[model samples]
Target chain A: MIKFEVDNVSVEAKEGDTILGALRRNGVNVPTLCHMEDLAPTGACRICVVEVDGMRGLVPACSYPVAEGMKIKSRSPRVIEARRTVTQLLLANHPDDCLYCSRSGNCELQTIATELGVRQRLYRGQRATRKLDVSSPSVVRDPEKCILCGRCVRMCEEVQGVSAIDFIGRGSSTVIGTAFDRGLNVSSCINCGQCIVVCPTGALTERSHVDEVIAALADPDKYVVVQHAPAISVTIAEEFGVKPGTDADGRLVAALRRAGFDKVFDTSFSADLTIMEEGSELISRIRNNGVLPMITSCSPGWIKYVETFYPQLLPNVSTCKSPQQMLGALIKSFFAQTQGIAPEKIVSVSIMPCTAKKFEAQRPEFAPNGLPDVDYVLTTREAARLLRTCGINMERLEPDNADTPFGERSSAGKIFGAGGGVMEAAIRSAHFLLTGKELSEPKLTALRGTKDRKEMQLDIDGLKVGVAVVSGLGNARTLMNEIAAGRSDIHFIEVMACPGGCVGGGGQPIGLDRESVKERMKTLYNIDRDDALRVSHKNANVQRLYREFLGEPLGHRSHELLHTHYGKRDVLR
Target chain B: MTTTVDSILAEYAGAGRDALIPILQRVQEREGYLSTDAIVRIGEKLDLPAAKIYGVATFYNQFRFQPRGKNHIMICRGTACHVKGSAKVLENISHRTGVEPGRTSRDGQFSIEVVACMGACALAPAVNVNGHFYPKVSPTKVDRLIQDCRDEETN
Candidate 1:
């Protein structure tokens, strides 16, 4: 660690850490736009300028490293003026319509501007002209609101391992876009929505489902059943002024009830069912030589990445709908039959942390019973907005339980929100089914952490079970490359497109600091540990669903409702 | 200066022709200029052996691959750029050519590139066409004077 005195403040930080890192660690609020803690600093925004004692000019805290015993003035007059000037120059070219912008209350620029106390731009004239591109089903791109920090470009290239978008043209005319300015749907974009999450303004946002959700709630004929993803429960608490990683599961159920949801269910229950189907498929593939390296198809972002970038690997993906879709299918068919409600009156709404789920729910194959199984998908942020609009103070509300059949889930299902949870959940059940001998230690500790790639070789009864789990599209690329190169020998693999899995999804709360999200991940794992029903196969609700609705894991009913197929991309070709 | 240029060029050569992206970036970074001859020599060293390098250089707007003036200015013309008053800034810089983004100026005093989305949306109608990041850029503030490669001032 390196210790330094900055303007009479004693601060200590690890070696190789930037001045910004040190200052942020000390709770010094130095504003920034282009810089994120997890990303490399390009020093493009010029917002975090700080005055150094002996230095000639204001230096950007983000890129500059602190030397031993460096004296720094963080809130000096010159530094403040420099920051204001930079923001002014940025605002000169930025849109003045913040009131109507989707990011109005939550915009980083707006927050910084208010913090800096600047009301208006000194210079103004004709802005640049370019039409907004809203062609993609999942994301909306408004170039006019863009600040050109290259966060989306960096996310696409460095994080997603997909260089689908880039900065094209030179000064003043420079813009971030797909090659030849093609619409995003035409590009190799995986619709992961990481770009949308990283955007500091309204440049990119999820295609709004507010009106559709409201309409569904208003229709008295419809029985609107809402299912909450495991990750959303942990993150929705932040919107209610609660600390990060607080599991507001009970409050979430109550809020959905207030939002006019006829029945509030937990997708974790369906997640348990997904494990039964996917786990059975894995064992079958291993025994029948069905396919090697059978990949998990839970994350739609990862699924699309496979379609666009690794189409040749399609045969390896699991043939099960994500837990969200599986629940939607069950709600419309099995739950409808059980409740004695007409299938047509069922309006299935899913609140997920995943932005890609928006597109995944709309796929043609998702409609199993001649109707869209999942009628509406709201992001975690949207769910928070709904709660706030309904005057539901989530923090004050008493914790309530989820509805029957769909509400009952296991620790295995709860863990699915984190990176290696799916692999751990699958192995627990697979070991039980294959060996007829339950695991002595239910926690598959090897497949239950935040590492990018985790691999374990377990002895299940007499046979060896080798498995791998990976998160983030970039990490998935590295894993897939290993498999393609004949370097991997794992039997089963779980992949999530975003780092830290669904809890760190692109549709979660905006301005999500990495440290805060990591804490939430720990909470999710704790939720897994604290529950009595630890395994998916052991969940009473899953057992009941299979017995009453679907006869068996790979039965005809299961195949018709839960199974799916993959094909190569026609656009990339 | 020669050592600085040589070492930077050597880094690009080690990366190969696919290194064209980083090479063009280095040339722009080192000399603060991208001469056509520099592009040709870099292409020859990388063994591309085709106009592919030059085509790529012109294809994406960021690659200058040509010598430019001391001051490089960029004005954003993205959707936010339109909404943020980036056109007036463009008009002010229109007095120069060849270095005016797609085309920089005839004189070696300035060069420009208009980019799409710089991800600084809250400060939209932004411009980094040059190496400088002008958040809320305005047209009236376009007039400027001379400078050499000495400033090294970012943003």
Candidate 2:
């Protein structure tokens, strides 16, 4: 650590840490938008300008390094003026429609506008006009709201390892976009929604299906069934001002019930069903000389990344749709038939911690029946929006259990919401199924945690099964590169596009640090531990669904509804 | 000599929509006023093709895509360059070159372009004459910078 004194404050910081980091460590709030903690500092915002004693002019604190004995005035009149002018220049081109934008109260641009005291636009003749890019299924782009901070670019390239978009041209004419300004749906976007999470303005937003959800609820002839993803239980509390990582599963079910869904189910139950199918598929592949490195397909982002960048690896990806999609397919097919409702009258809804699920639902092939498998997808954020619109205080809602027949799930099912969670959950059932004996404990510590990348090998029935788990697209790139280089000997791989899986999804609450994302992921594991049935095979709901409805894993019925295929894409220009 | 707007538009749209950037760069690279039609036609191809393209084209100080005189002069307006009296340097360049930024000499011999944050902070008050980095430039050095470029053009 390097010790430095700035403005008589002695601070210790890492060698590569910027002056902004040092100051922030010492409780100094440096104004910045381009300096997110998870991303590398671009110094583009110019909002963290500071006055140094000997320096000729103000320097951006985020990019400038702190030298020893450097005296700095963080909030001088000159510094304030420079910062305010920079903010004003940014606001001059920014759209003034803050009140009606989705991110209104929680927007970083709004916070900056309040901080800078920008009352009105100074340069009004003609601001740069850009057409709204709403071609993507999951995310929308309003270039008018873009400040050219390159946060989305950095998030896509540096974090997600998918450089599908970049800044073209120079200076004021510079704009961030996909290659040839192609529609994102046509581009190689994985639909992870991390870009929306990092975006400061209304430029990037999730595609909403509120009207469809409302239509489902209003249809007296329809039976609306909702399933909440694993991570949603932990994060829904934050929307109600509860502490981060709070487990409000009971409250979430109650809130969904109050929101007027006919049945509030658990995706964890479907997650168990996924394990039964996926686990057996893995074992069969090993036995029958099928694909060796079978990759998990829970994350739409990872799946698209493979399709776009590594099309040859398509064979490695699991043929199964994610648990949420599986539930949607199940609800529309077997559940609908069993419950005496027509497939058209069964409106399936999924509460996911991801924005990519929006795009997943829109796939033409995803509709098993004449109607789409999932009628609508409500993100964790949208669910909270619905609850708030209904005037229901999430914190005050009475605790209630998930609807029966589809509600019961195991601890293994619950853990699938996080990184490495599926591998751990699958092992619990697979080990029992293969060995005909239960393990002392189901916690696969080797596969757990929020590490960027991890590898482990386990001995099951004298067979050494090598596995690798990766969270974050950058890490996924490293693993893929290693595979490309012929160094990857792992039998199975699990990849989540977000840094820590769905707990840190693009649709989750913004402003969570790595530590906070880990905390939320831990809550998922804790929920798993508290459950009596920790193995997927033990879930009675899953067993009954298989016996009465689907017949069996990899069966004709299962293949029709639960499995999916991938196609290659020309994402890069 | 006068150039038609059609040729410039065709050249800007020749490669791709993003081709306008290098086209404008080439225009500024070649003759030295951004043809307004070049900007308009480039916008037309991009679909967002708006008049604001002109505003942004003019906003940043570094664009000049037109025919200039025999000699073209550029002065650095970067932050460190600004601190070392680049505004005064601009005044002196205007005095010597008989042209301000985005302007050409009445005799059609010299054009001027000013830029921001040229990445040469260590050498404050920097300038590039005919694609050569001239660091630590001052008002006194302006006359020589112009004369050297003019001398090269004549030679």
Candidate 3:
């Protein structure tokens, strides 16, 4: 530890800590627009400039390292003026339609400008030409609002390991775009939308399907049915002013019902269904001398990334549809048939904690005919907006249960919201299918954390199975290389493109740091622990679905509706 | 099998990620611009993403995506040349040549590329045509410059 002076108060800081780190630790808050806690500080925004003794000019506090006995003023008059100037310059070229912007109150730029008291734009010049790129299904790019902070760029390249978009032009005309300035669909972008969350301005945002969903809800003929992903119920509390770590499961169901959803279901039901199919697939592959290290195929972003970057691994990925797609197919096929509603009239809308689910829903194969299995995919944020529009305060609603038949889910399915939850869920079900007995403690505690990669081996009735769970595409890439080199010992792997699985999905509440993601993850596990049925195989509704309509786990009807194939794609295209 | 691009890529076959900039530089030098095919090939050989390669290539002004014309006109618009009415000269050239800065004519006979400085401050308005230098050029000289390029293409 070293001693330093911040605002004339002697403060002790860790050795080799930066001024920004020390100041933040000491509760002397300095404004920063370009800083993400997980990313390396590049000091691109220059909003955190501070005065340091012996330095000729104000230094960027984010990247400037502290020394022993260093004198630093976080917000001296000169420092405040410099920060104000930076904010003013950024605001001068920005669009004046803050009231109408989608990210009005949540924008980091607006927050910093308000903090610095920069009410007036100091430098006015030629603003960047306004161009909207709405080519990608998940994310929208409004280039005119870009402040060139490089947060999106860094997030995509460093965290996701998909260098799909970057700075394309030079100087005043510099633009961040995909290769050759082509549409993101044609580029290597997987529509992950991590870039959308990190953007300080409204430059990148999720494409809105709220109006269309509302229209569907209003349509008399359309039976608008909604299903919430396992992660959505855990993370929706943030938008309702509830505590971050609180679970909004019952409230979300109650609110969705009030918002005109004909019937509300949990995706965890199909998550349990997915476990049955995926677990059976894994066992057959192992027993039948099939593909080893069968990778999970639930996260659509990870699926697209593998398709673009590592297509050869497609054969190793499980063939089961994601719970969202599975539930959509079931809602349109099985649920529609049982309810006596035409599949066409059933507008299958899914409230997902994922942006890639939007792209996945739009996939050609998911819809064999003109009508798709799922009509619209709304993010957790969009669903919250829909609830607010109908004046349904989720926090105020009484806790309720999801509708029956497709509503019941196991604790094993609920845990699918977080990283390694799928693998943990699969291990429990696979153990029962393989040996006809449960593991002493069902929860694979080793694979429970929010780490990028978690690996553990379990001896299930004399059959030793090695499983690896990876979240965040960057870590997935590292594991992919190992598997590509034929050096992997893992028999099964679960991959979620987002950092902490669906709990940290790109379509979840925006601007959520990893700390909040961990808290949201706890909600999933807490539900898993308290639930009566803790195993997927024990979900009575899932068993009833199989017994009534679907004959077996990997039977003929299950294969037709619950399974799919993948084709290779050229990344350059 | 022995195409110029193939040979260019073969030289960089084993060179890793750091070779991206140099590979792009040489490819652009030889091909006059960085084609999508070339960029994709470079990415494949270097084991890097095409978007990342394009990102680095675009950071440098020397790289171009469009093909250069037969007559590459290099106009200096540095401090010394701009003060000597190079803007008007540039306007005249653009009007006569019927092309914007950093673009080739429709017929592919001529192209205009503006440079910061050509290290010819003594001339104060030097315009380099291919390798030949024309100093102290004015708007009146624009017609002759186009005519000369057209005559050379015809002859």
Candidate 4:
């Protein structure tokens, strides 16, 4: 431990700790804009500058190492002045449209400016007019509002391992953009929304479909139906000032109904359907000597990543569509048939904890006869906003159940919100398909946490099966490389593009830290622990759906509606 | 005849990212500019993203994204030249050719660029076209230079 004096208070900090880390540990609050946890500090923003005892000028606390006997004044007058100046300079070039910005209430820059008492613009200069990039169906880029914090750039290149955007050009002309300053749609972007999650300003946001959804809701001829992902119910509570991980599932359904959806469905029911199809596919591949080590295709971002980077492994990915798309297809075909409504008149809308689902819903494969299966997608944040726009407070609503036929889901489907939940769910069903009996203890504790990667080997009916679950595209890339190099121990793999799976997705509530994501995962596990129906194969509604409409898993009707394939996609690097 | 991006990349076989600059330079030398296709090929060879490679390439002003025109024009905006009204000469050339500095004309016949210094401060305002320098250049001289290049193209 190193002893230091912060604000005249004696403190002890761990050796090799940065001054910012030590000060934060000591309960000293020093504001920072460009600093991200677990990332190498760039010290680009001098907002965390402190008045060190021996330093010639104020030093940035984010990168400066804590030294023994070092004296620092984090909130001294000189330090405050320096921070104010830096904030003023950033604000000088920023747009004055915060009232109209998507991040109006939650922007870090506005909060920091308010804290620093920057009431008025101190320095005004000619603002550089930058073009807005809205080519991607999922994410939008407003370069005029960007403060050049480089958080989105680092989050894209370092954390996600998809360098679709970077700092282009030099000095004052530098702006974060895709290759050749082209549209992000043509770039190597997986549309994970991780970049939008890390951006401090209103520079990055999901392409909103709330207006069109409202328009659909008002149309008397359109039978607008809505489905909410499993992760949405857990994380949407945070947007309403409720504690993180609070299961507002029933309340969310009630609120959606209040917001004028003709029918509200649960995507978890389709997730159970995914497990049935994907698990049967896995068992068949094992029995028939098909593609070994078949990877899951639940995450759209991971699908695009594979399509762009590792096109050779396209055949290895499971042919099952994601829960969002699966439910959309079912809503148009089965649900519409059951209701005696025309498929074209039924508008399928999904509320997801993802931005990539927007891109996934728009894929040409998901559209049949040039008619899209899913009409609109709203992120959890956007859903919260829409509910608020309709004067529907989740806290005040009574708990309500989802509509019948596609609402009932097993706990195994509910756990699909977390990273390794899919693998555990699939293993339970795959074991049943192979041995015709449920496991003694269905809870695979090995695959139940928020770790980046988890693997387990199981002996199911004397067949040794190896399984691995990985979240975040970077870790997926590493495991993929190993698999490509002929490491063939694993028989099935589950990959989610966002770290900690959809609970930590790019389209979840913004400004969420790792702790919130862990809490959401814990809530999903808690739901699974307490629920009665824990296996996807035992879901009565899913079995009834097969008997009523689809013949069986991977059957002709199922293949037409619930399964899809991916091909090589050419992108800008 | 110019070499292909594949042949140039093959010469740097078994090399890492440290060979990026040299590979880009070689491709630029052969192709007259760093085309998007060339950048993508280099990224595939070096195991880097095209955006990162483009970022690095853009940091240095030597890399050009557009192909050079038939008549390449470099106008000096050095300390001495700016004082001698090179800005007006630049404005005149841009007005005549409809090409901004660091951009090529639509017809692919003329390109304009502004350099910091050519170390010829003694000439004050100077313009260099196709490796030939015209010292103490005025607006009228720029017009005449454009006409001479056009006349040469007709010939």
Candidate 4 lDDT over residue span A1-573, tens digit each = 899999999999999999999999999988999999888999998899999997898999999999999999989899999999999999998989999999998999999999999999899967999999999999999999998889988988888899999999899889898989999999999999999999998999999999899999999999999999999999998998888989999999999999999999999999999999999999899989999899999999999999999999999999999999999999988888888999999999999999999999999999999889998999999999898888898998899999988899999999999999999999999999999999999999999787899999999979999999999888999999999999989999999999999999999999878899999999999999999999999999999999989999999999999999999999997
DockQ-superior candidate, 2 or 4: 4
Candidate 1 off by > 4 Å: A1-3, B1-155
> How well does candidate 3 score on lDDT at residue A522?
89
TM-score-based ranking, best first?
Answer: 4, 3, 1, 2
What is the DockQ for all candidates, taken in turn? 0.05, 0.03, 0.65, 0.84
lDDT tens per residue, model 1, A1-573: 787877698888888888898888898888999996577799999999998888898899999997777888998788888888878877887888998898998898888888998787776745898888888878889988898888887887788787667776557866777744668788777788889889999999997786788888999988898999989898888876778989989988987887799999999998999999999999999899898889999999899888877899999999999999999888888889888999889888999998889889988888755688998888998888877777777777788999998898898899899888888889889988898877788887777667778889988867777888888898899899999999656888899998879888988888776776787888988988788888889898788877877999999999988888978874431
Share of native interface contacts recovered by each model? 0.02, 0.00, 0.71, 0.76
Chain B TM-score of candidate number 4: 0.86
Residue runs of model 4 more than 4 Å from their true location after superposition: none
Docking class of 1: incorrect
The candidate that achieves the highest DockQ relative to the unseen native structure = 4
How far in Å is the alpha carbon of B55 misplaced in model 4? 0.9
Candidate 3 per-residue lDDT, tens place, A236-322, comes to 888777767788889889988888999999999999999999999999999999988899999999999989888889999999999
Count of backbone collisions in candidate 3: 1
Q: Per-residue alpha-carbon lDDT of model 4 for B1-155, expressed as tens digits?
A: 23499999889999999999999999888888899889988898899999999999888777888998899999999999999999999999988999977778989999887888888999979899989999999888988999999999999
Report, for every candidate in turn, its global Cα lDDT versus the true structure.
Answer: 0.81, 0.80, 0.88, 0.93
The better-scoring model by DockQ among 1 and 3 is 3
